[model samples]
Target: MVHTRERSLLPTEEPLSLLRKDGSPVEDSPLTMPDDDVLLELHRRMVVGRRFDTQATALTKQGRLAVYPSSRGQEACEVGSVLAMRAEDWLFPTYRDSVALVTRGVDPAETLTLLQGGWHLGYDPYEHRVGPQCTPLATNTLHAVGFAHAARLKGEDTAALVLLGDGATSEGDTHEALNFAGVWRAPVVFLVQNNGYAISVPLSKQNAAPTLAHKGVGYGVPSVLVDGNDVAAVYAVVREALESGGPTLVEALTYRIEAHTNADDATRYRTSDEVAAWLDRDPVDRIEAYLTSRGLLDPARRSAVAAEAEEFAASVRDKMNVDRTYDPAALFEHVYATPTRHLREQAAALAEELA
Candidate 1:
């Protein structure tokens, strides 16, 4: 009985992976492959997603975006997780997950608005079922848990997927959120994209766990670890978790091939060789190779996908380039339902200055 009780709480012995680095299948893997239609869609989205991430990063250099955390090598994790969810499910993403946001159908321009120094969310949360891209570490997990628990109380079948980094597992809020999700068995999935760094700090310094997925067991949540570069594996794992009807924590072992963000210099801490090794494991290339090997993709299909991605990048570039006027007074409007005396005074002072 004790063994039975603990059976579901432990994570897989190894990080589940469907494909090898050479785009070959893993022998005797535990998970089955997704259907051909699903795999083809994953490949196309990954192509667009990589182009989107590259375009966003370039925007940071061009001063169109204040900053961007490139998800260059982690497209599989971003696209797979989003594609696994149902239309009604909610996604809580970190500031690094702009690719995931785009995969969820949010307008690329609206997705970058927060990084463009805008105070308000560019898109409506209700319409997209996505929260604002959270910059603060691990806080979104708490929100995800609360929303999932509330949905359960209302007898809604909606589930929530919250993305996190390896460093966020050390945050207090993540611990609390996992604990509550476990006890309540809320329909929420916590995806930890362990990209191996928390702003120049390596996982060696940030965590000492056997693996991040093991952190979930302590909170009574089932855990699974997957090779983050394998799109089929990621989609399969996340889709299962969302359909499992209980809280789950999934740790995807990916890497940050680029610097932490446009503002940080990664070379100061990481060696050139380290970055090169991860670049060879590029997620987009892996899926494209796999699809071609299976005859699921040909040169014509590949060229068509590239063309579509270029179109997407062009749209984002055009939208981001258009200049827009801003009103300074709009900042104070959302701070309070009714402005206090001090707030009124500040607004008046700003108004006088503008005049």
Candidate 2:
């Protein structure tokens, strides 16, 4: 007997952008006029995120942190989407989303602690309204869907913004979460930072389909593609989606421009020429140029922002150097609200070994 094989459903590529690479408005783009203040804020946050990435990368090399994921080319996507969120809304971030976490009011010190592996997490999720930085790729999307569903059941008006990468879309959890969010009409934003590669696997190899945004349409969620490097576009799309009060999938077309993580070397898989090409369209430079043209950012103000970022980076470095010892027993304590017998036994055994 012959069996028929099921074909995988994939998303189609969609048209992108409310703004051009040169900050020119795309006539057909859905966004109307861009606010100057919003643009400036986006630019500032991008600079700050870039600075953080740089410092984190250096810290990893110096053995201060276990690992680091550089969001160098994708700062605008994170900062922009973060700026669109309300304080009460929850942010579900991947390990690479340090910028989004910081923009959503997570302390720099807390982020450093998490990155340096001093604790399972540095901040209370309730206090910051940000979920843990999930290291398991696309698993957090389902968590965001559940959180949104719960919020809806509680009659809350807030939404949940879930951040994932292009590679994550390939994960089973990514599709399941999207399906659940759509079926329930959960207030969730599925933000896909399409940085062109999933580790060493380029987007082309990841899927036969053109783009991740199209994945939502079949699930009954509205989707959009945006210039991930253009903070204005990201902010506009995210804000509109949040206001719409339903699931929205946004594929931010950007580039990684760095290694997947500090432990991985890009030189082995990707070429320097590719990195240089993306750097030429650096999101930070684009926003800075726009601000300079509009006189929103003068040299003095720009210098001030740069200096502030430098100081912040220094503070993170200082904090990372501090004593971060934790009780060995505490590890088993937070493993569950109530520990199971096996966990308790393991914890006790570990504690005795340490003692």
Candidate 3:
């Protein structure tokens, strides 16, 4: 049977943007622009998130972390996505989005636990309303939709904001989740960080749509595209989606400048020149330029921010350096409300062997 291929009927629209590579505004400031303080905070958080990624990569080299995924080039996308949510809103992050979790108030050390080979998830998902950093592709998209649906039924004013990569958009679960969300009008915002590559597979190989945002129209969900490297643009797009009380998708056109993870080598598939061009559009540099132009950031403030981030990195290092001895039984603790007979027997056997 020949299946008719789905294609984007409409040409891709121009993505919304507030800032450019030079940090200049794309248009005049709003009546109430993001205050100098909010802009500074956003800049500070992005810098710290970059430092966290670097420190985690270093830990893997030292054999401290089992694996590390550097969110180097996509900081603006992750940071902006999370910061756009309200404190009470929910976040569902992918394994590649430790920066988003950190931006949403997850402790950096705890956020890295799953990546460090620790037992179960690293932090209390309830406390932060941040779901586990999903390793299995597109699985948590379902969870995010369900949670938002439940919140609507409960008459709660919360939205679930979930993040995924361009590659994850290929997964069947992603399609199903978005379909259900559209039908139910679930209060969920899906952030697709279209970083060009789903691991080593480029978007051209995996996607045929004009833009990832176009995927939503089929599901009766609206979508917007953004310059993912622009913090202002990402945050603004996400901010609206989360507040609208219906499913929305934001496709951020960005690039993953690092290997998929510590274990993957990107050099084999991508050219040095391509990576170099992205380096020129680094989000951290762009934000700094904008802040400087507005006179919100100066040399002293820059040094102070660097020092603060360094201190945060040092603390994460110190915490990770301490040896952690997990109780084998804890693995059996959270899988279910009560342990199954088979699990109980296995847990007892492992305990006996250890004893």
Candidates' lDDT values, in order? Answer: 0.90, 0.82, 0.87
How big is the positional error of residue 81 in model 1, measured in Å on the Cα after superposition? 0.4
Model 2: per-residue Cα lDDT over 122-143, one tens digit each: 8889998999999998999999
| TM-score between candidate 1 and the true structure | 0.96
Residue 301 CA displacement from its true place in model 1, Å: 0.3
Stretches of candidate 2 exceeding 4 Å from the true structure: 1-15
Provide TM-scores for the models. 0.96, 0.93, 0.94
Q: Over all chains combined, what TM-score does candidate 3 have?
A: 0.94
The 10-residue segment with the lowest total lDDT in model 2: 1-10
lDDT tens digits, residue span 88-207, model 3? 899999999998898988998899999988877889999999999999999999999999999889999999999999999999999999999999999999999989998899899998
Candidate 3: what lDDT? Answer: 0.87
* Native-to-model Cα distance after best TM-score fit, residue 112 in candidate 3, in Å: 1.1
| Model 3 worst lDDT run, 10 consecutive residues | 1-10
**Can you list the residue pairs that collide in candidate 2?**
none
lDDT of 1 by residue, 106-208 (tens): 9999999989987678888898899888899999999999999999999998999999999898899999999999999999999999999988888989777
Return the candidate ranking by lDDT, descending: 1, 3, 2
